[model samples]
Target: MDRPDHDRASAFDADSRRRVQVLVIGGGQAGLAAGYYLRRAGLDFAILDANPAPGGAWQHYWDSLRLFSPAEYSSLPGRPMPHQTGAPYPNARHVAAYLAAYEDRYHLPVHRPVHVTGIERSPDHLTIHTSADTWHAQAVVFATGSWQRPFVPAVPGRELFTGHQLHTTGYRRAADFAGQRVVVVGGGNSGAQIAADLTAVTETRWVTRRPPHFLPDSVDGRALFELATHQVRAHAAGDTHTGVASLGDIVATAPVRAARDSGLLAAHPMFDRLSPTGPVWTDGSTWDCDTIIWCTGFRPDLAATRALEDPRIHLLGYGNWTGPASATLVGVGRTARTAVEQIRTLLG
Candidate 1:
């Protein structure tokens, strides 16, 4: 697919080729966080992001969506999100604006709208090739995050009906589907939120692969923000090597419970088949719908740098780490502070 052209793309010149201590491949929360720590440690690094603006993945969310996390919890290190005229849960635009402001405030050196096409490593440095330019660095951090690509399941006749099929990533607002019968697949947080928002303006149905455990946005006056914090602490303390196992447990207990009790969502069985008309349930039931929103999930796009054996190029830390002169992966921590600390230590 052709990339969006909101920012100018620059060509890589051999004479202009620059060397840095670290190369951050993403400009999202994780990438910026790593940059923050690297800067504090006085390390030479640069951030290359595909988006025209900072705020990372937040810019792709629906228009009416607000973060489940409050402003306080969402703030990055050494900077605070400017408060808007709203409650604790700021909408997607607000979050995006905050990240943009952060980039300006910190003077973060980021190459915007430059898509990274591939990455390779030499004996002493890493080579990052983008659509616009190439970068050479001693270490590269894949802060691209987990949500690199949207996951849409292969269903029969998916292309036939297609009135306006979109993933949660492309969904902007309920008004886009006003007065339409929409069926949203996946009962995760995104699925629930989309269904709930659409319910206010259109007929909606939520289909899931399995019964999801829902939790309230809050529990006993405590937000679920602590979950990320706890995982970061555990990883930093060497008590755990992976954060997914712990995050999965917390998500199961919290958001899963909240969504189930929302009473706005109607849980349908797994999607058994798809036709031009609509999707069929596992029990052989059919529901005619005008639009289908896939909220399945996403995966990291590491094909660009698959040849690298450095710890920096990992898939949840499951890839091979047996390369000469071990290259450390920094900023994999789940929480903001913990991720910053990890970057700090790695840089040191």
Candidate 2:
């Protein structure tokens, strides 16, 4: 099989930072996908991941998180994400296990606990500085998925609110706020699902910049992915189409459906400003809130990449800065392949 196959061990100098043809940053799905293609092309490369374990940010997801897609649809390029015998949709931990196994199965030379500090460009090669050592490479691919950087928008009275404020990153379990009041902000899936989950234990209010759109209960992430694929293909072919779903639309998962049936899926426009007591509406009405769960999303963790002056540094998956599916697990494979081919062309 022409996959990210490995035949020999990674060769590094005694300093543990030796020069290779290419270096891949971030060992999450994106990085792993890049490794697959890079290996198939038989390039000498190494993958560096920051997490001490297999899962990148999957290890830190909220307790109740579930993939909107079933296991078959949620996998990386070569391997189908393994799952529990009866479980249709895999949880975060299941994904974590699959990723760990995928790395081992392919014998991908992944170095762990190597938190990248920065990147520097030299006349001959790019220098990757990590917590461990410095490495030299002729080319670099950035597959660093954007989970480390959580983004919360600026709002009035953000400093005035002394109440507990947490982004979705730090949110673990809903029971922590069992008796409290929460204002879950954002219109995306996380905001919808988290608001729904919080309703089981807390008095929750859902706030969004715009109306939250939900796909039919029969629809899930697979459909979204296919729709996206269609859109990309259509764009390539210069065709216009309609009646497909974007990934941003919420999926009516079991939890979400239950919440909707119980009248918990209602959404309100974003409040005027944040107050110590809660959020205040334009009419100056206030709710007694104790926490604002900002499911506000994240930005691309491209700080180090931006600092480089080289034109050869190509970045994958940090969200569509590259392509339609640049940031997605299933989508990054094609993006990686295209990137590697481009790198080969440049190297020639």
Candidate 3:
């Protein structure tokens, strides 16, 4: 990654430096959620986001894609996402619009196009260096969600291939790959959805390392949200790390089968070997593709704050933080209200 270039000395004078009580890094859903609470408490804070607008990760999704979660469950604090005309799942554009609205509604102070270069702790405060300015604060909250970086597996001859290769972030619409052989890698929701979308205009194949379990949008006399909430609560009580695995297990119990069974999709195991020609399957089968879309998921980037000697930082819930004092990762299909309440208590 490239470090941002900014004339730090010319931007602010010694006495005119901008300072806040708290600095929130990232202006995505998580950051906005935290900002909502902070605003309610009348705390002096500022949010720095890399994107030009709010809604964070949603803005980077494919234009044709819709959220896997319905609008009801997707709204942030202090605002409701508007309904769409189609299925319960709102499309990507709607989500982006909703996020923009959330920022406007709450008047969240988010500085856009400000890439965070580094996070360092001073003797009396934390300094957040961005592309254009440096923010000083008594405390810092990292709301830079888990998807900061895209993971593309390294395959020999990957660059030599003539086909168009893209991570899920760069994917836009099906028209871009019309009439081409497309391979959607990773069995996660993004991979599945991208495969489904491409199939309309091109020959598509879905590949995964492990056969992922799929469930209908609805399950067992209740919505998936209900089940997800129950699981989240259980995890919050004590269990951790098994939340994703547990959700998959529960989804497998449903009578609904894999979406691939509809003849619209083909399932293949992990890519064993790769050549410029195509990816070789474990069974010695070969599949030719003109385009490769990797939706393999993401990892948390704490490199900027690696020097901070805070073990509690890792304990913060995914999307749920017990205020600035405690942390919990609560956003992977879970609500952050309880975590927010906990933070309020600690801060109070």
Candidate 4:
């Protein structure tokens, strides 16, 4: 239920801050999963998302990005991702649409346009401060994902480089660099995909710390999720010898497949340094590049949570730290369920 914007002020004055039993920070995949379990448990929880609307981080992914998993594998706890006829693997738009509907289907009490800035802990509870409102929560969860905090390596001469430089956060399209030379840094799928995208329009170089590990062409994220799950179960049972591919290994999407067919998947080892123009390879050679795109991945956005001393607050959907691959849509359900149960016990 929504109050009029005019009435919201009276609804949430400092002394009248709405208190929730639990507060889930972030409304992305992990946050939604947490909301699902929290609702089923009948917990008085509210999810706060910074995004203006649904779709979480998907809304910000590159235009050509696609999930490596099928619809059935990319769904939330109770809802299956609506199947798209042509997109065997859904793209960013498809995911954003599904998330918007999922929020409605369950009527998850997700508050959007609510950007959490920090948290303050008191003897009995936590106070979550956001851009618009302040929330007093008995228990808090940190599901704020990593995309907001992209990682850029500190290569030598980084400051002196005069060429265009950007992290994947700002990269929009290959056409943006149509006639220029592009250097894509990172060994992961993002690097490979972006490199592939740029190949259509520009001269490209891919530089990685090491040669990227590629999963079998037939294998995709679903298989990796299952493998990760099995590993988690095996670990619980004290079995040590488990082997399966991980998300870090690149999957050959259509563009990547085409790149491979055309012998454009070549990746050079990390350059020794950055020159004013481009990367200088360890071999003392340099490539002239007009732009450098760093797909170097992200760190968990736990800056605020890092200050918490309260065990009542939990963080979900940030890889094995919260649970296995907990950041991914399919992988978040278990973590969220487990976290809610822990919170339930703590509350008891």
* Clashing pairs counted in every model: 10, 0, 14, 0
lDDT minimum window of 10 residues, candidate 4: 1-10
lDDT of 1 by residue, 1-348 (tens): 112222322233458776787777788776776677667767787888878666777888888676655566567767766666856667777877777777766667777777889887777677888887677876777767545678898876677765568888888888988999999988676787777777768888888777655553333112343443455467668876544332332232333344445665677777777778888766788888899999887766566777655744422221112111111122222333333445456546
Task: Give a tens-digit lDDT track for model 4, residues 1-348.
Answer: 223421232233556567999998888888889889999998998888878667889988899999999999988899899888898899998898888777777777777677787888788888888887888888998888998999998899888788999999998888889999999999888999999999989999988898888878878888888888899999899987765644447888888989977988788899989889888877889998999999999998887765556788888888776778787888899888999999998888
| Clash number for candidate 1 | 10
Q: In candidate 2, how many Å is residue 178 off?
A: 1.0
Model 3 alpha-carbon drift over 4 Å, by segment: 1-15, 220-222, 235-261, 311-348
- Stretches of candidate 1 off by over 4 Å are 1-15, 146-148, 160-162, 220-222, 231-263, 312-348
* Ten-residue stretch with the least lDDT total in model 2: 1-10
Tell me the RMSD of model 1 versus the true structure: 6.2
RMSD of 4: 2.8
Candidate 4: lDDT of 245?
48
Computed on alpha carbons, the lDDT of every model, listed in order, comes to: 0.64, 0.82, 0.64, 0.84
Residue pairs with backbone atoms closer than 3 Å in model 4 (clashes): none
Once fitted onto the true fold, the runs of candidate 2 whose alpha carbons sit more than 4 angstroms away are 1-17, 240-248, 307-311
TM-score of each: 0.79, 0.92, 0.81, 0.93
Better of 1 and 4 by lDDT: 4
lDDT of 2: 0.82
Which of 2 and 4 is ahead in lDDT? Answer: 4
Better of 3 and 4 by lDDT: 4
Ordered list by lDDT, greatest first: 4, 2, 1, 3
